[model samples]
Target chain A: DQQVKQNSPSLSVQEGRISILNCDYTNSMFDYFLWYKKYPAEGPTFLISISSIKDKNEDGRFTVFLNKSAKHLSLHIVPSQPGDSAVYFCAADDTANTGNQFYFGTGTSLTVIP
Target chain B: DVKVTQSSRYLVKRTGEKVFLECVQDMDHENMFWYRQDPGLGLRLIYFSYDVKMKEKGDIPEGYSVSREKKERFSLILESASTNQTSMYLCASRRGGSTYGYTFGSGTRLTVV
Candidate 1:
């Protein structure tokens, strides 16, 4: 079973516009959510994260909003740039496990037209 | 910068051949992991080690084994490689406990013919 899902495989946005990527989870035990950005031929880099206690977390141009009631989270990039184009993955931490195993979604590929 | 290094970027092996994928971390992390990334399946953990000489199986550990002889190094072994095993292998390291995220290697693409 897929605990986390990113239904949209790809998304495109115009430069200077907003780019939003959505993710949903079925497991309620997950308390921490993270977004990772991956470039071609490189490993994923951490972008932003939010705890279950917070509804939103922002870092410069990147912001992540979490809704526990919906079991959903989104990553928003304002004034999106060409450099922001890459595969974005949503991951959740399973706190109930001793290893703190992280479950990752299928990932959403984003392309920003500059 | 903290880094996880996988030994090779690409490899080609014949079926039934033994394969070894090596990973090392420079951050002195206490936790290390091995994962396989497929086109549509996302990243699935193969195994992980929280300390030297200790290991645990992840979601898909079949046909795979791991060794962690040193604190900074972890190795994934494929005793008999198969075509279905061809995929991108990633190694990651993180600090022990529940507070940190993982730092990953560039990944090694292995193809079993």
Candidate 2:
């Protein structure tokens, strides 16, 4: 069974509009979450992350919101730029493991139209 | 800056041939991971290591093996290549525990003919 899930396979947004990417987790054991943006032929780059203790974490134009009660998380990119297009992956870590091995979601391809 | 380097950008091997993919990290990360990404299937972890000479099987370790003899390098080996194994392989490394994020390398596109 997939513990971390990103149900949306693709999302598109107009430039200067807000783009929201949603993720859900079934494993309550997960205590940390992260988002990574990947471009073709390259590895995923770290975008933002949040600990289970906090409800939200924001960095510049990127914001990650965690709703513990709903077992859901969402990433919002305000005024989306065309350069923001890529495949975004959501990941969760098992707190007990000191190795930082993560469970990853399928990913969502986001396209920003100019 | 942290950087993970994969040895090959693209490789083509014939069926039944052995293949090797290498990854090196200059960031001195204690943890290294090998993952394969397929179209629509996403990234699936194959193997990982936390320290030198120590390895662990991830979700899908079949037909694959890994070695970490030194702290700076990790190698993934395919005993015998198969067409089904043709996919993009990613290597990543990170500091210990849940505090930091991973630094990944440019993927290697392996095609087994």
Error of 2 at B19 (Å): 0.5
* Worst-scoring 10-residue span by lDDT in model 1 chain A: A94-103
Best by TM-score: 2
The RMSD of every model to the true structure, in order and in angstroms, is 1.2, 1.0
Runs of candidate 1 with Cα error greater than 4 angstroms are none
Clashes of each: 0, 0
Docking class of 2: medium
Show the lowest summed lDDT stretch of 10 residues, model 2 chain A: A92-101
TM-score on alpha carbons, each prediction: 0.96, 0.97
Q: Rate the local accuracy (lDDT) of all candidates.
A: 0.92, 0.94
**Highest DockQ, which number?**
2
How well is each residue in A32-96 modelled by candidate 2, as lDDT tens digits? 99999999988899999999999999999999999988889999999899999999999988777
> Mind giving the per-residue lDDT tens digits that candidate 1 earns over A1-114?
889999999999999999999999999989989998988767888899899989999999999999999999999999899999999999999665678668899999999998
